[model samples]
Target: MNIRITLDGKEIETTAGTLLVDVAADNGVYIPTLCYQRGKPCLGTCRACSVRVNGNVMASCTVPVAEGMTVEVDAADLNDMRKALVELLFAEGNHNCPSCEKSGRCELQAVGYEVGMLVSRFPYRFPPRTREHVAKYIWLERDRCIFCQRCVEFVRDHETGRKIFTIDDRGTHASIEIDVALADRMPPEQVREAAELCPVGCIIAKGVGYDKPIGQRKFEVKSIRERTLERSRK
Candidate 1:
């Protein structure tokens, strides 16, 4: 069954139970996503896809389409809220964009550009976090992690189907933890997949940095919005 919902003042007819984010994207609307991956269970950790649903703020990636639903994806206030969320991530994390290996390819950096974030309004935490290269194939740069939970939910041990990445502690002391044994057992392709799954440079693959030169990176070839919308069409 198909349901009609109003998105950014345009009525769109989409399959019932389809996520609002996908519905909007199918209709050529771009809603920035940080932790949400298409066809996967909603983690709802980043909340970058938050939009007004029936005049209330909700995570679009988690919300299913409903009849008569009114979604405000492009509203000015909503854009400002999204922009602030990006800024908060920047202020909370030590994201040295220019120096980071994921510079041009980082989704956070691309989204920052899309949101027109010149500088964070909030004070930078600059919390002391050490880089971890203990794993045989992975580099753990804790400072750049935004707690997106993508690695925790998506990347897993193929044989055991168990989580290879997880979070430690809660709130301010929270940090991402990896099962070194499971991580080491991961195939080379899977190892690269884990690093690619990361939105930031946090989960870098050891011995793989600056492989793609300037203008050849993921987001560099085309803007995130363009790439996302283009993907939606295919």
Candidate 2:
């Protein structure tokens, strides 16, 4: 199926199932994303990839292309919306980027910079922190979760092949939960993958802090798109 869409004022042709992010990238109009992973399920929870489709804000990761579809990437209002969303995420979580090991490489930090979010407008919640100690090598920080569910989905589908992780509670109290009460039940490699899959530093490897150093990290030299494409090829 063929779809003709106007992206950033240029008409482009794409397939029916093409995601808005990929479409924009194919046309050299990059749409910022944090929760979206290529070749994975579309979570659409992170509003960072939200774009103006015809006139309304929608998650570009999940939005399908259609014939004659008019889409705007990085429009002023859309950028403001994205910036506000990033700020809200920052305020809701314990994202001390400067102190985090994932500082320069963190997707949240990169997106925040791309959207020009200098200071958070919303009051900080400073919510009580919680941690999940999984063996001696993995820890899950509930306070930093933006509820992206990349970990939950990845662990459930890719690693365990079972519904091991789930989101519990609702609306500001929602959290990721493991099906088993015991921590470290999942393999260490799988746990590592899940932690790395998280867009933010919500989940982290237990002992591998700052091993690469500041000058050697992937994000330090390459854009997120470049990094992501490189990973995809590998």
Candidate 3:
């Protein structure tokens, strides 16, 4: 079931119907992603994974490989598109990575660094958001959320499949919520899972965070690009 496609001027052979993200990674092409994880349903909420396919911009995680397709993952315009998406997320929320507990390990911050985003192109809103602390093990910091919907879709009630996180309001006023009653019943692993699911610092585990010193945390040691691109160079 091998299919051939061209990526950035090079020919790549991969299985048909394989996700473009997986195909790119297998062929030493790195495409940034946030809301798409292996084995989980893709939300495509964040357009960070966009790549140009046959001259059209598409979310790579949602597209499958096709024979004779020409995929562009490293075009200048596509890179700028990814950068703009990251910058918009920064301007839309109160990331404040320097003061946040998830500073070094935060994916959004790592992505900003990877994309060379020195400053947000859009004006900062500094929008006021309420924090939810009702959950015993996990809490919500609305200001840091990017509405990725990872927890809402993946971290459901272990038994009944009820949503543990949801959204309220609409558009600019919308915010994320945690089902306190259901969250309280979540096992310790699920509590950690929920916190880790967040690409930003919005979802936090009560007893963790702020423990790692600066320049010593996950992404701090090695940037996301280094992790993704270095392997390709090998």
Candidate 4:
């Protein structure tokens, strides 16, 4: 089935069931996404890849290409909306990129720069940090969590063949929680992988400190589109 959609004033036709992200990428339209990787599962929890579809803001990762769909990739309102979302994430977490390890190479930082968010308008919540050292090889910093559930999704559904992570609260207090029973027995490698999958420095490798300098990180090499395309090709 062929589906035709208008993106940023250009008409593009693609096969049905194609993701909006792939469609936009193929058409050279960039949408910043953190929880989405090319070869990975689509966890629509991150609102970063959102776009205006016929005047409605929605997550492009979850939206399948539809015939006659009018998609606006860079509409000013959408951009502002995404920027505000980024700002909220920053205010909620302990990003402090200047002192963190993933600073220059962090996806959250790169997305902030892409959307031109120099400072957050929302007052910082500065939530209390929870440090869990169950793995010893890795430390889980709950403060940096955006509650994207990428780690939970990857660990339980993708790698472990079981659901070990889940949201433990509701509304603004929702958070990613690991099943303590399973988390105690989970392998260090799996924990480390989950930590690495984090777009922000919420989960940090214990001994592996920042290896790259500020100016030489991968995020500095290309725009988010180029990076996403490169990952897709891999």
Q: Give the TM-score of candidate 2.
A: 0.89
Q: Which residue pairs of candidate 1 clash?
A: none
Residue 75 of model 4, lDDT score: 76
- Please list all clashing residue pairs in model 2, or write none if there are none: none
* Ranking of predictions according to lDDT: 1, 3, 4, 2
Ranking by TM-score: 1, 3, 2, 4
Best by TM-score: 1
Q: In model 1, what is the error at residue 210, expressed in angstroms?
A: 0.6
Give a tens-digit lDDT track for model 4, residues 1-234: 997889999988888878898888776777888888765778898888899888888999998888899989787888998899899999987778778877766788888988899999999988776666665455666777788877777776344578766777876677666666666566777767766688887767778778887677777766565787665555
Clashes of each: 0, 0, 0, 0
**TM-scores of the models, in the given order?**
0.98, 0.89, 0.95, 0.88
C-alpha positional error of residue 109 in candidate 1 after TM-score superposition, expressed in Å: 0.7
Candidate achieving the largest lDDT: 1
Report each candidate's C-alpha RMSD, comma-separated, in the order given.
0.8, 2.5, 1.9, 2.4
Model 2 lDDT per residue over 44-92, tens place: 8887889989987799999888888889876788888889999999998
Local accuracy of candidate 3 as per-residue lDDT tens digits, 1-234: 898999999998889999888788777777887787755788989989999899899999899889999999887888999999999999998989778988888889988887889999899999999899988998789999999888888898989998989988889988898889999999999888888888899999998869888779989898876676665456
Report lDDT per candidate.
Answer: 0.91, 0.77, 0.87, 0.78
Residue pairs clashing in model 3 are none
Candidate 2: lDDT over CA atoms?
0.77
Clashing pairs in 4: none
